[model samples]
Target: MKHLAERARQVIPGGVNSGQRSIPGLTDLVITHAAGARFRDSQGREFVDYHAAFGPPLLGHNDPDVSAAVAEAGRTVDLCGVGVTAGEVELAETLAELVPSVEKVLLTSTGSEATFHALRVARAATGRRLVVKFQGCYHGWHDAVSLNVISAPEKVGTHDPISTGILPEVLQATLVLPFNDAEAVRRAFAEHGDDIAAVILEPVPHNVGCLLPEQEFLETLRAECTRAGSVLIFDEVITGFRHHLGGWQAISGITPDLTTMGKAIANGYPVGALGGRADLMELFSSRPGGPAFFAGTYNGQPAVVAAALATLRKLREEPVHEHVFRLGERIRTGLAEVFASLDIPALVTGYGSVFVGYFMTGPARTYDDLLRNDANMFIGYRRRLLEHGVFELPLNLKRSHVSYAHTDADADHLLEAAASAASLARGDVLDLTDASTMGGADAHR
Candidate 1:
């Protein structure tokens, strides 16, 4: 809270570039280094990390294998023209083999760019103008995806948020619908079927602390999109490798026409991809007779490409789903126990390795339901947890992704922190033993 904030505030807007980073948690220590499950902050405080860099870092920070792969790739043939690279071409094939829906892959720098290009492809392929997206689910800061992202619940009732700094007309071609309600999706199609190009969404909405939809609802969405001739795009950037090797779409038996993925594809390295039915993906692939050309200088940098290949190969070998599922269950149960003690009605949402904690009694099925949950409780817990040497993504609404690095022991420590913080939140602020176990104990003063 000393030189970190003062120095950062002098240079960076809002004291940080990303909105989540500036959140006041435990003296707002800036991290200097991280390994497996632990990170050492600039203030020299050590903490168990669960934020995982906004759903990346699935293999944990600075994985030696991934780091080594990147270094070797860089030292070998660092620069490749936008034309082609054997490394990227092989990585694309690997993606196709892993994600059945993707017959070909178009590389991109981040989830937003992938979605942007995917939307353009969908429009060209379908010959339509409007697009549909679920409310509260984030697809990055790009115009189409950012509309109606969030409005803090009390301000609006299931409408586009505008989010400030965005041109109002930018959202004119976009339609925001309530998530997990098949009726709403159906109604959109019924009204604007002919004009729609794509219905894009995160197959698992981890953006809002992991708001999962009804299975039937997801099925119905796929069905409606098909009937309306609109492309169905699954933004599986977070859930692809984290949920399962293929993703939630595979588990739910829903196939999207276009799918975008990032985050865990290269562990912590920056990499992203968009792919689906070859016919649709070809819209972006340059053609002799067609008008689409997707190319970038750093689209498939060799280092990141190598990292993705190595990370995916490891996942293929170990198959981490089973153990992560168990860990997720234990964490949910443990957190439930904490909330129970505090006389608060709460539960964790999403698949194993991803979770959203809610403080409401109602089941959070839609964006609105998730929006109504306890923000104050989350902020309170976040402050206490960080002070106790646990790092989170700051705000209550963001999804927290777990990684292979977090053990059952780490889960136990987290549960203890949640329980202690819940007490603080309820105004009881009970004195607990072993406060020193969580670093930054001086933060409370």
Candidate 2:
């Protein structure tokens, strides 16, 4: 057992919250140092990290320029958390420039806080209480958004309670609808449209393992939210600065009233930003009639903001996403071939830099499609991948992160290991239901 696990278990709850890092057998391999997509675990095992800390390290781990910027900012942090910093304004303005819809921006320490404050603005601006969210699209674990992330196995569209600690009053304000179902959205709006303060969602649903939105669904959401006088928020915490300098909204071209960004903005540093049109942001303005007050000690830490500035500047010039997309597709296609060779039912999801393996029967278009996959087998595959020096975690597993540090060479190496891991997992599945334990030398016979 990794010593960190024993040490961490005594202090941190769950040892570690990152699903990929906290595997049952191998928290010891949980990485001590990382740079440019490769990590060295405590035991000196190496891995091409795919879970870029669940979605932030867009510039890859330990980028020199970002590190330098953070260092430079350290010199001036005498002003950090002291009050206002030019670094904050610069990062905010940078976001406004990159994301055309963002005329004003606010910073927070984490995505949950960003969403929490953004939601407050949404409600106070509209003078409404209801908050709409799509099932399987996770915004954050905040009380307001902690419900109905996925429907129950027996039913679609019905909201399933995820966390029990959420207050009943908070749950009452949440309205969870099935993803990509415009009709369900329309019906919700038809009933409580006027009361819905905002509709917050991940444009590309990553919570259910990197599921993409159906064609025109995002456009329809923007249109619906506008017509209903409710704000639209894109929780791009995972997507921001991920695929490109513009991110998913830039690529998708479906702008929301507000967008929450973190993770990759600073390449693993803690930073989150809420940005949107000036008028909507006016709700957070300090005026007496404005929406609410939002502030934090580390909300705009110079080090993190500087890191973001460096990452963004690099993204504009380097075009690393093209490489990430190509490598991502390579991994997906390679995994498909591996599954086909073994006749294991599985599929790949995600675009550009991010990708996820769905151990399901068919394409994971909706939550129902996701149900056809074998969760246990996926978990087993995750364990085997770690054994093979290719680390991975289940989608149902808590947030995992990956980045551009992985090269084509790394992708090939991972796929080669994945083929063996998939075969091993298929063997385990065979043992589960048979009398003969007949998943022979090759297993699944």
Location of the lowest summed lDDT over 10 successive residues in candidate 1: 436-445
What Cα-based lDDT does every candidate model obtain?
0.76, 0.73
Off by over 4 Å in 1: 1-5, 25-28, 154-159, 428-445
At residue 153, give the lDDT of candidate 2: 68
Question: What tens-digit string does per-residue lDDT give for candidate 1 at 46-157?
Answer: 9888877786778878888888998999788876564677888889999898886999888887878888888988988888999888876677767776765555555444
Q: Which runs in model 2 stand beyond 4 Å of their true positions? A: 17-21, 27-30, 150-152, 285-289, 394-402, 429-445
How many Å off is the CA of 257 in candidate 2? 0.9
Cα RMSD of predicted structure 2: 5.7
How much is the lDDT of residue 12 in candidate 2?
Answer: 77
